[model samples]
Target chain A: MLDLLRLLSFGPDGWGDEIAQGALLTIELALATLPVGIAIGLMIALAKDSSSAILRGLGNLYTTIFRGLPELLTLFIVYYGGQMLLTELAEHFVEGAHVEVNQFVAGVVALGLVLGAFSSEVLLAAIRAVPKGQKEAAAALGLSGWRTFRLVTFPQLWRVALPGLSNNWMVLLKDTSLVSVIAISDLMRQTAIAVGVTKQPFFFYLVACLIYLVFSGASSVVFGKLEDRAARGFKRVGGH
Target chain B: MELLHAIGDGFLSVVGHLGLNTELMERYGPRFLDGVWVTLKLVGISVFLGALLALPLAVARVEGGKFLSRLAFGYSYFFRGTPLLAQTFLVYYGAGQFREQLTDIGLWWFFRDAFNCAVFTFTLNTAAYQSEILRGGIQSLPAGQVEAAFSLGLSRFLAYRKVVLPQAIAIGLRPLGNELILMIKSSAIASVITVYDLMGVTRLAFSRSYDMEVYLWAAVLYLLMVEVVRRVWDVLERRLNRHLLISR
Candidate 1:
């Protein structure tokens, strides 16, 4: 019913460019943060597995705090809290030195931290899914820890963990839109701005929804295919 | 010392303003409590409604009815795929665009109330998520159980309600609890549209105090609420699953 082309014009007045850029930023933010999340997740799983009581406590506390809080609210804390910390750091680290984490950097860190907390659980499960016998057998063979982990543990861990990690990635992607709150100009925020300028809340918001749907929809298919590829080894060799 | 002094002053201002606290208590304290009551009412109603709506959609996915199933699949795809904030804004502000036609048909009354709007949007959002979990849980059920139920002359409804639903509940509780946590957080979004829960109080406090600390206090309130809710839900889930003797 509404004129769709005029609604999405790439011109200065047309939000086409901003919305498109927002979509790109959302994807990039998610992709950039996945490694941080995965790495932190691995460390968390390790900590949870550690014999040290303090390590176990820290691991438990990390997941409990991050997972317990709301993502939207957490974004606010990071945007503000991270600024306070960096400013506090600047006073000590550099004489009259100033370093600022912009909204985008703060966003990536905040979202990734949250993602890391959730991803840790999935990683813990994945790591455990690797058989105990393999570790024991590797120890019996007198292989060094690094070789045993690299050769035996991680390969299977990746296979067991790929689906969950990808699922976390999709969530990370969608939640990046939340950072638009601190005015990172990501897709949803950009769409809201476009709606404000165009005086067409309905049209712009609907378009934003469609954009998210398309992105996540494509990701689901891709993730499913990846899972299938990961499982292909088992299929060919006969069932686990 | 200056920052510490500023913090001390902020604490003093908050504490010394007994009149402010008293005034807030006098004016909207009941209303705030009512808001909490309404939120509980909303979360309870929406979760149940969401679960109910999810069941048919989940069953359709598992059953694979041609046209209707495809329609359900599309519904889940569209709803689950979109962000909840986008949906909230669309329902509250975007739906206002069609008020004239909606009013002409007398549907305006339902849409006019912010609470109804919140419940409706929240129900749809949670329904989509819950349905996927339900579908997965149901699929996880042993096929032989269905056969055994049928072998005992149980009808589909009885078999599902007694056999399938119980197991699905146990399987689905964690995800469902996660959804409930999400619903609590998302309720704060409703404050943007004039349904004051907690953040609404933050706005009011900021206007009066003109301080960022008001928002800070609000954030602490939210953090505390989330922590309490998390512990409570963890206990409830553990209680529910005690029959299985599995440690979560």
Candidate 2:
């Protein structure tokens, strides 16, 4: 146990600082990906719910492809394929300039694409769950389409979308581990390094697991509070 | 005419580059097929084993006493809260740390093989998710249905066996299908531990060729597998819910 503590302790011999840094990277990666993902999800939800057939088909295809593929496979494709594409383009346009995709960018883009896919499905369902009459009522009040959506639909949509989106967020947090495979210095990658140095895979992995549990456990509480806040003006019929 | 020829040449060059990987495919084609087979076996066995384990645990969660319910809850909570990749690493590597003790108990052989470790980890992980889905399905049933079973002179166990389980299974079919799909996707993580599944083969092929086409081919295969699963599940869902379908 003393040996374990020393190995994890902060110093030249310890991986404590590296692991701490990795944890922060994981947080940063997830946060950076969230808004982009949510924005794409919102657009997709709108597209799927829109009256246009072409937009709906495109939205469905995007979700199906992303959600259906394994996240790791998606990451690999994004990282490697993006690099190849960029290199090709650079070679064609620039005489001798080289292009590269860093792991951070690759991780964010891949994860955000996937996040958008899953969250769009959730958001689409949430949008449908909002009563149709509410929109008509907004229009009856002489509210324009954009104003009605902003004032009425979007606010209610979040409440309806909260639980599913929260689940997606939890999943996104854990799925960030896949980025470690690409040599990203995320929590999982850092733990892998620690395991390599300390020859204590079990100890370091257990620590990683605990760190993840803390993140998820805290997120659950935070989401629960947000859910309660979203439901503040609503009444529960059976007190469920 | 010049612009048209340039456009044609550009398209042909792109195709030529992508198509030039025939040698890579020829060399790794059999290996890729073998990897797919291994992946299928891993998913099949783990999901089967997981469902078998989950049923009783789900029952315990929904109907058993405080101790059993809490035990079930704790298992699911821990497994669900952590990343599957971490759990895989813990099992694959962490188990190695206790080789002596495990060997003493004659369990080292299970942990020694990456395939076994993967199956074991995936089984436990899927079981946790499956148990929760089952518990939810059971809870979702109208209370009167179970009461109706009891009122028909069925004992509690018989009531569950005769009435509750069948109905819960029906309601649980879709979520259970979703679980299976998730398990299939997650089985790729086994590659990280050198299991040589599809992703593992892709990694090996890429190491040799450094061509991105290998990953593309692998992704296409994965997409194909997912599509089949989705289609099959849709058919199954319709068949299961046939009685519940409303007439237009």
Candidate 3:
């Protein structure tokens, strides 16, 4: 145990610093993913709810394809295929130019696409959960279409959406570990390296597991608070 | 004719410049199929075993005494809070550190193979999630149902077996399907420990040929599996809830 602590400590010989940095990288990756994913999710949700058949079809197809594929396979496709596509485009556009995608970017794009696919379903359900009468009333009051949605629909949609969105956030946090397979030095990968170096797979892996537990535990508390706040109005009125 | 020629050139360029190696695909295609089979086996066994394990666990969490409830909750919290990959590593590599003890207990045979270890880890992991889902389904039942069952002179076990389990199954159907799909996606991690599942084969093929199509093929296979599962679940849900639907 003493040796384990020394190994995980911050001195030159300790791997604690690397693991801590890896934890930070994991957070950065998830932070970059959250907005891009939510934006894509909103767009897909809107498209699915659109009047046009084509847009709905496109939205459905996007979610189906992304959600069906394994996250690791998606990561590989984005990392390797994205690299190839960029190289091909660069060659096509400029004689001597080349574009590159790093592991971090690949991880974010792949995982974000999956996140968007899953969350779009949640958002679509949330959007639909707003009572039809409410929208009709807004229209009856002569509010414009966008104004009706902005003033009447979006607020209610969020309360319905918060639980599912928080579930997605928890999943996305754990799924970030998949990027370690592509050699991004997230917490999982850092632990893998430590295991390889120290020949103590159990110890390092337990520590990594604990670190992940800390992250998920902390976020679950925050999400529970958010959910309570989201439900505040409904709770006061005896609504579920 | 012009379009045909351009297509041929594009194909040749993919073959030559991209180094797709048709010969290698022919060689490894069967191996990839074997990987798929192994993946399906892993998923099939784990989902079955996990469901069995989850029933008792869900019961413990929902109705067991405090100690049992906390034990179940702790199990789920520990498993759910961490990444499945870490759990996989802990089981796979961590088990090695205990080979002597396992051998003493005659369990080393189970841990000696990567496939068994992967299945064991996946079963434990999914049981946690499934237990939570089942617990939710059980809790969703109205308390009045239990009171009604008691008024009708049904014993607790009989009430649960006849009334609660069926309703809970119906309520949990969709989430359970979602869990199965998630497990299918997750079983790819088994490849990390050299189980050579579909993702493992894809990795191997990519390393050997440096071709991106291998990953695409694996993705397509996964998509097909997910689609079939979704369709089957839809049919099952309809059948289960047919009585609840109005004729209109």
Q: Across residues A125-147, which tens digit of lDDT does each residue of candidate 2 receive?
A: 99998999999999999999999
Q: Give a tens-digit lDDT track for model 1, residues B1-248.
A: 89976875675567557434544444444454565666566777888899889988888888767987898889998887887778887887776778998899999898888778888888998899999888888999999988999999999989988898789878988888888887877776666567766656555655574444544555556567667777898899889889876653
Candidate 3: lDDT over CA atoms? Answer: 0.90
Candidate 2: residue A226 Cα off by (Å): 1.1
Q: What ranges in model 1 sit over 4 Å off?
A: A85-101, A136-144, A235-240, B1-42, B151-153, B192-194, B203-248
lDDT score at residue B44, model 3, on the 0-100 scale = 96
Q: Kindly report the TM-score of the first chain in candidate 1.
A: 0.89
* lDDT for each residue of candidate 1 in A1-240, tens digit (9 for 90 to 100): 547667798986577999999999888888888888888888998999889999989999998777766676577667766776787788897777656669988888888788889999999998889999999999999989999999878778888888888878877877887787678888988898887777677888889899999899889889888888777656554565
In model 2, which regions exceed 4 Å deviation? A144-146, B1-20, B246-248
> For residues A1-240, could you state the per-residue lDDT of candidate 3 as single tens digits?
898889998868989999999999998999899998999999999999999999999999999999999898888899889988899889988997767789999999999999999999999999889999998999899999999888788778988999899889989999999999889999999999988898889999999999989998899899899878877667555456
Provide interface RMSD per model, one decimal: 2.1, 0.9, 0.8
Ranking by lDDT: 2, 3, 1
TM-score of candidate 2 relative to the true fold: 0.92
TM-score of each: 0.83, 0.92, 0.89
Question: For each candidate, what's the DockQ?
Answer: 0.42, 0.72, 0.71
Q: Which candidate has the highest lDDT of all?
A: 2
Measured by DockQ, the strongest candidate is 2
